[model samples]
Target chain A: MIENLKEIKKDELLSEVKKYADAKARFVTAVCNDLGDKLEVTYYFNASPGMEMSALRIAVGKDEEVPSLTGIYLTAVLIENEMKETFGLKVKDIAIDFGGHMFLAQDSPVLPMLKEKKEAAGEKGGE
Target chain B: MAPRTIAPFGPQHPVLPEPIQLKITYEDEKVVDVLPAIGYGHRGIEKACELNEYPKNIYLCERICGICSCIHGITYCEVVERLWPVEIPPRAKFLRTIWSEMSRTHSHLLWLGLLADAFGFESMFMQFWRIREKVLDLLEMTAGQRVTQSISVIGGVRRDLNGEQKKKCIEVLKEVRKESEALIGVLANDYTVKARTVGKGVLSKDQAIALGCAGPTLRASGVCEDCRMQKYQAYGDLEFEPIVETAGDSYARAVVRARETLQAIDLQLEALGKLPAGDINVSVKGNPPANEAIFRSEQPRGEVFYYAKGNGTRNLERLRVRTPTYANIPSLLVMLPGCELADVPIIALSIDPCISCTER
Candidate 1:
């Protein structure tokens, strides 16, 4: 229960993130947690140059896809691809999609970090 | 249109001895686009952290990056301490600050050595590393280990610095400063060194911030943002400013690191002079309370972000680490596309890519 963590809908991620970008707040990184029923993806930003920081917490359904922030911040490509590769969470239209091959090897277990790990997602996901 | 060819740069290369392959599209000599493939060294440390008890994770986190291990361990402990709402003694905070600065000094020297090696300056590389050995000796003398000190613990640091060790450390640091200045002067005045790095891999201030560059990479681009500005640990007790360079090129990055190596020494001297006297460690018991926390600490390369959610049990529900190298990779990707193919190594090395930390 950290203070200054704003709860927002998944659809608002882009617009809300744009506000941070407009405010010139640095795009820190996005963290995703598997909360059993849904994923709680939080976007963290340093609201001020010093210590003041804030996070936007959004709950996405287990199978839902979150829009990519790369459209607003080009650096989102790496972390977004990581969220796709490691968590097996869906991030659409990543500016530079590694086709989910950015990190994991071909023979590696799929979504090994996800709580409900799966091995068949990539063979099913578009290559 | 000139024909474009895509070439694989490395999971292994002479310049970068790490496992990061940059599949670069090149048109003649200039890079068209780059796609970096990592995880060759990924060990899934976050998942491992979840399996371990909260208190035992101090060592596990320290192994995230061998070069800057102390800060990772310290950051993890600090974040967990926040969860516990516990206050360590004043002396522990001071010890942590001294060790953290020492880690920074050694890590920056290591990076400068690597950068020197990238430019084929073998003698300079050895010289930089030779001075780095003194800083490492200070760590070994105080904490029992050179690279991965593992001094940080959940409640406080595991070791204390005696008066003899502190006095000797100060003397050694002064010598280290003198030796480093001789080489840093060469780096500043060497024409061949400047030609290779002066205008190479420039990331402007706005591009740097939008791309989310951290540490010297961001500061080199003229952004004055350092997590130490947050005044965590004993940092508030010291008076210093983050070193910034405006060119945002490879040379500026190198200069920032070289200057920071000196600044870190000054910081250690200040911390040692103002050493607070108190208990080093307080006994910590029980598991972290069931709550979430977000912690940020400035490491050698950049900022490290840690998110921990405790379940009131021994094991954490989630422990996510966003390392500096991981953040810097995106900026690397952006920096590579427009540069010459031959400049890739020094340009990429400018960000001080740490594959182990990035993958973890």
Candidate 2:
């Protein structure tokens, strides 16, 4: 488990990200996982001058829009576009908004991460 | 204001080995902005990992990128092993370290060859790959394949090195280190290579860390950071300093990698000498429990991060991978601007951007 995981409300994300960015923490990628009714978004950072991994997680409802971290951590632009495209998380005011098509072609499955697909147990059909 | 000419750099280009495009907006010869366009080669590997049982995910993870496949396999096994909190035999850790270093050795040479090729030094490119072939031979002799060895299992490595193979590996590596010095010398001393790379694509120390760059890209900027320092897997036993160069330019990046190629060779030789006598793997029982764990390891490019959550079932509830290239891409926004268009390809290649690893 993430030892330094700090659970924060969705509203506190930008400020929390601001605090890490203020400390000049290296902004690692953000992970968004499909929870039944909501998406769990986790931002990972390695504290500056050290390798301690710290994470801030916020739970978001499906339709809720999260503020972009690109304002503070410019690296967020790509991963945010990814979260938007795959999980369909609405991130408002991105610096370089790909408009949910960063890694997806038009007519591709929309929000592949948002779907509740079943694991193919004891079967490897996609080879 | 000069009228901007926006050119799409690539979904397919001469410099980039894989499919990733950068929308380069140039004001005459100098670049003003670079917006990236990717996703041409996305295979939904993470989505596939979630579909398979925890044990089956190893194969899928190993294929994430052909060049860095061994490290991918090691990282996957390490992350899942952390879930079970499995204790691998000491011999296995050394074996993994040896193989991991072998991967780093070949990968750096391949990048060096590509970097030479990017600068239009065709003969140097051929020379670098010729040395890389030796490393590939060593990997194939030990693991049964050249690129994606698939030697790593959940608890430990699937194969072990007998005595004859160990002696042969040491002899071949020492010769590799000796031969590499001549080619690497050219990178350090060549005027044309230096003119093209020395002051180009400069990412400052602060920008490198703040932008989340990794591997040689991060180290070359003088951050004193490497995932190996965290000592996951067998790296704890392997004592070495992370290579650092302060210029933060493409040449500095090249020097860092050029030196690291030698370092990787030294590391493999050390691990081979320290090979312990014991069983290679421990039997892992039961499925992964309800656990969420994060693992970070140094690949040839930089550090790779993996997050896995098990639902107490055979399959993982969620699997996330954040590759080094993905983290380093945004730094291109910083590097490309203010560089002459002629220098773009070398600057892009300096990051050693593995788009297959990035897009996956």
Candidate 3:
């Protein structure tokens, strides 16, 4: 439900994100507010252009990652792992037991995303 | 203590439509561990979007999913429009809404037919698909293309719904409504369907929400998380509620989708009746600003997320699409364990795994 997206300065956003000490609550509040929800403003982070920017995603309601609710947001681990794989951003402590090599195959299709970006830049003569 | 036997389910199976191999470690019939090996159909569509212009990318996006092509194209157009911020005409919005619901009806019917086939109910499958033919005929009549309509554009839709076409759509919807009601009666009251689907592959409300499940899958699990509730296009003006079922099992999912098909038919009729007379396409001016926007739309299977990054150019810098089947895959994996081998097809079909959409 990302109704509105506001791009803020990286440093200021990181400082805002630090305000919410609890990682789970902080993540939820940041996502909710980013999607134009009237939730209590907690924390914000300025993600890097290609890396952090791609990892930036918001999931509302029960999908938010909190240890209290374990199995409900199971796909959040995959989403977070996908972010880590594609953009090199870490999601702190997530993932129950890595599905191992089987899950590794999911990352295979994603390599092209990062590779193509570099290849396109090279084609443009290091633009 | 016994060593676990590892067995590969399939990269290709006679039953499964998509090529997904599951490396299942089994202690006899019980699956101790499952390793899903995907990436057989990855086509780099998102990367290709960077090479194509915004308008042409709509066609490319439509190709992402044959069943939900209109939604994909609409989503791509909306993402580009978000960067530009142009107002779509009410007439166009209404027409788009109608088309969207029509697509939904056909998709649900198609899935229902497949589910019936999975359950080994060939007669039911044939009947459901025979009913679905009416929907396909309606689509062909209106869009002039059955699968990839390419009817949607950036500012608005490509074609206008004329008076005669509107009448035809209404008539077709009326026929579909009658046929679908009969089909629904068979699905609901029929003993064979209930015996096969009920109490199978149950994902509770908490599990559904936690897994980021969307569309009928989440709805069946009692989570009222329909993207249409956000009122995109003419959905804001329309009156409908998200179909919900408390069971959270395969039966519930089937019921949710079946009910949704009926609701879609009703919505299409309402849209056609309230078809406004106005311009179809709005002229977009200048290059899109360097900004990013996330566009979420309710596809036939579930929610489709499209992230578009514009850099004041005809070509989009980045485009990321997250299909519902990808989200639902985790739930499928969890449900697969502890189920009998005979029930595998039904459980898989319950989520309506559209691998092409997911792999794209």
Candidate 4:
């Protein structure tokens, strides 16, 4: 269970992740939740001396560019690439870019996991 | 100075059983850098979770990794149970603990064999898998499956362990313990094993924590962090302590997993002795409320994370898993840069990467 989620703006997300990184916190993973209008990104970090978990949440419009945290926490590289491929969100300065071939096949549907409800229905009707 | 050459380590190689391609940039015999290209085994399982009903998703989650199958289902159930808020019986909790450890034992033994094979220790590789078969037999006897034991559901376990089955399990574990002790002795002191592993692919404590290395990999670096210590199931009542090794090298990682195999067996025996009586499962009749839940557990490789978001429907809105191997992959990137080219296979196998688990 995650608690004390402070919603930071997109600009502050990297510094916030770095603050925890300096506290010897292990970067758990980052997740993107599609909230219809705006997407919410939550990065989970676990700190010890006690296995206490704290998360930072940031809401960005679907087209907003979120800065990649791979510079601060090197492990952020994989999850960031995944977020780019699966959700089709624009990420700025990822440490490694697979040029949209990280997980999806080139022949596969574009942004298959990011379809909005009505758009999904329209696509389904078209097919 | 030796000229640099680009060598592709795999998408298929004799040493690797998976489809991850490591494009290695090498200067003569020393590796200068490695760029790993994955996703060859991706099955789009997470997207599939949004299509299936909640209960049936249990079986789908179990297939995420054949090595650590039970934990995937258990973690999924823990997330769903949080949303549905089902209070499972005590008997079911104990059963979950037992089966999870059974999978841990089998997974670790399988890794030990594979690590041996990676370094060209063929006879030792056969010996380790020989012990692994007995552990698999115990899992099959109880859960009726060899690899994917679909005992976990949304509410609780799908089956119960009887008295006779319990006794047989203990006996089989005793034989496993004896066989493993002999193999562990060889792993610990054998000159060839030590020569290949002792100083190779070292991940310091600071680096392991910074890179978020999980499970035995983190523990081997003297981190003292284990998801099991969080005591999610009946582990609170069970006596437990995480095994830690200070060296943080390939041998330390192997030693930590070897010791953990014995640790998992002890915990299983203790849970079996203290087994309680009650229903193995409970019935749930509705969709989860609109909310999100996260569950973490100690899988054999490291910490496994499950995140589920419910939208008041039979199918979940989103299901995300951050497997141990995924967390450990960056550490591989850190370790590979300075090692000799010939040592790459041994170094790669040390983390016990399950690309299927990572790419799923």
Candidate 5:
């Protein structure tokens, strides 16, 4: 159930996630999307005793960096490092920085997920 | 004082069947820090989802974790189902519940065997696996395959359980329960087992929550939270409390899983008895409306989070999975430090590490 999608300014990312942490919400996971010019990052927080997911989405320009949540929830380090490696998103102050080597091995394609690809040659685009 | 040393536990080891290496730094026999090197089993399953059509992605998801393959497919279907807003038939819901429970039973049994082997209990390990074989047989009898039963489709289950199969399932579950109970009793009372596990690799309740551990690992640390309690699928119709132990040690984690196996059996029986007669699947057609959905399920190890975004095409725009073991790995860093070098394998095994799930 994804009705709780809340958009946050990039600068407010850490403070907003901290509010959920203060309210005893469990940090579920973070997802990053490459939107060509900007990156859309969503951090999911789950409230217990019920099945509600609150997501905080932030859009960062290609040259910009987003604050890390490892200071708030230690578990965020792994996923953030993964985002750093996969989506090529820059995260500041990770609790344990694997140095862009969490899920992808060194010497693999850089930002493989965000690499540009041509659309299907002659297929109709999705409606 | 003895000299400090760095010992690599495994990228490959006898106790660990999966590919995960823990670079443990120790001061003599006491562990000072642990660096987990994963990605050995990464197959880019998430990226592969984009390459396949939305429907065919079910098979891809099922391959993410072979041990919990049924639930992986089920959760994937549920995520896609949310986009379409299709109602799975009552019988299909119950069947999903039953099969999910069966997967849980088999997974827990398999983990119990691996943990026993980690402790050098060879005979106990074999006994657990022997019981596990019967569960696999029950799965095969129903779904036509043992491991990686691709039963769940985009809408519902691909097969239905008949009366004869139901009766046989009950019989097999009863035998598994009996054998597992005897083994659990041995693990609980045996002095050597207790001496090895109790008060070892302790993770406090606060630390467990802060680290985002889930399922048995979180429950063992007295969090009393379970994704099952969220009541997705047939869990709402079932009755069971999250098995929690306050000790927050290796022994507590073992006990939580052993008891969860019994809970899974009870859940399967309850769902089977309440199975209703109806269509097993609804006819799902067309692309899901442009939308986003997140589905969470309680896997044997922990909570699995699936996110799907459809752009109204056959292929989903994005499909991301955050598996249980991925969340539980951080807790290993919390637990591993300060444990004795001898207890590293048992403590690591206690998390029921599934690198395939984590890396996928």
Candidate 6:
């Protein structure tokens, strides 16, 4: 029986994770590390109520840096890269060896989620 | 120590099926180091999911891997179906299982053909592909499409196998089995194949576990971790164990896949015999509530992990797919450095590298 964790604010989410980590693999469910705006926080099997899988929304405000979890978890490396690519979040101490070519087009006009619309009747007539 | 020459193996090469370039540092005939260069086929499939609706994304996800298209689609649907909690009908489950096994048969046969071609056994390659055509015809007949069939949906499957189609499938499968048995006999007992493949590109059991290799690659190394054992579909009702080999080499991998192909035929026959009678689908209404579900399924290559996040909408918030080839790449890197340059293709093929799946 898997329980779905609700969305928790950043501060409370961090505190909960720290509390679980202090217990060391006892309370914490499998933490699926995803690098994006939403942190998919999960509780292990038999996690108590109010302690289900919670997605913590990380704020990307200027001068308010996102905390690095690399010191704590090895799987955060790929997560950090995905965050930087998807959410435009700058992560510190996250080294990415791109191996020469840029894989993500961060500034493309056609966002995948947005519906494609024809160009407005015109800045310029058909040449 | 003399300076070693560095040469890139492929972004495109004849021997390599997928576009994976290995920057190999060679000391004459011996490889000192190999750095894998991937992302050649990356289409940002994860990003694409954001744009497409959940139902439409099924097609998008199916194309994630051409060989294991049905499995990919089924896995994606399973994740979404979990969010809604729709109980798929028994007939649908049986149909899904049948198509899945058919896909597996064709995929394994395709792999065998490529493996044969990799070793320069051109005639064997042709014979295997000729047998594989029957499986493809069956897929087209039942699913109405050959490759990347969008047969599965969130609630249940989109199509049902009628009695006539089922009989046709059984006939074709029997013919395929006969042809495949003959081909398997030749490959299993042939002098040249054994001479070329035996004791080549070995990966010890410990190394395989340590590197987190999955599916046939790990099974070939004697690790028995198969997701199908969990029995997501009618696999629970059916009976089978993970096929394994203790040798952990290219030869073992070949033998494992070859043997598994026969097992697939048997599984299909059993599934068809035990085909249930009922409605194909239970309608799933409304958007899925905010939920996260993790689904795992064994594709032709290995165990695939899919994580779906829904926020009570037609469009899913996030869908992440971690394919098996990505996990196997590290193990492949380990195998390449010790083997000769000529043996590289066979060793790489042994892992069944699907760069499209990995890079997507």
- DockQ for model 6 equals 0.11
Q: Stretches of candidate 3 above 4 Å error?
A: A1-73, A80-110, A115-127, B1-3
C-alpha TM-score for every candidate: 0.96, 0.97, 0.82, 0.96, 0.96, 0.82
The candidate that achieves the highest lDDT relative to the unseen native structure? 2
lDDT of each: 0.87, 0.89, 0.69, 0.87, 0.87, 0.72
> Any residue pairs clashing in model 3, and if so which?
A13-A44, A16-A43, A16-A44, A17-A43, A17-A44, A72-B210, A73-B210
Q: Taking the tens digit of each residue's C-alpha lDDT, what string does model 2 give over B31-130?
A: 9999888888888899889889877888999999999899898898898888878999999999988999999999999999998888888999999999
Worst 10 residues of 1 chain B by lDDT: B35-44
Candidate 4 residue B239 C-alpha distance from true site, Å: 1.3
- Decoy 5 TM-score against native: 0.96
RMSD of each: 1.9, 3.6, 7.5, 2.6, 4.0, 6.6
Once model 3 is optimally superposed onto the true structure by TM-score, how far is the C-alpha of residue A101 displaced, in angstroms? Answer: 8.2
lDDT of 6 at B168: 88
Clashing pairs in 2: B215-B302
The true-versus-predicted C-alpha distance at residue B33 of model 2, in Å, is 1.1
Model 5 ranges off by over 4 Å: A115-127, B1-3
In candidate 6, what are the lDDT values of residues A1-127, reduced to their tens digit?
Answer: 2444445554564475555444332121133333343334342311221112333333344224455444443223444444444333445665333412323442332223212322444422111
Tens digits of lDDT, candidate 3, A58-92: 33322233221123234654544444343323234
Q: Give every collision pair in model 6.
A: A5-A53, A29-A43, A29-A44
Cα lDDT, model 4, residue B66? 88
Give Cα distance to truth, residue A51, candidate 5, Å. Answer: 4.0
Model 6 chain B TM at 0.97
Docking class of 6: incorrect
> Docking category for candidate 5?
medium
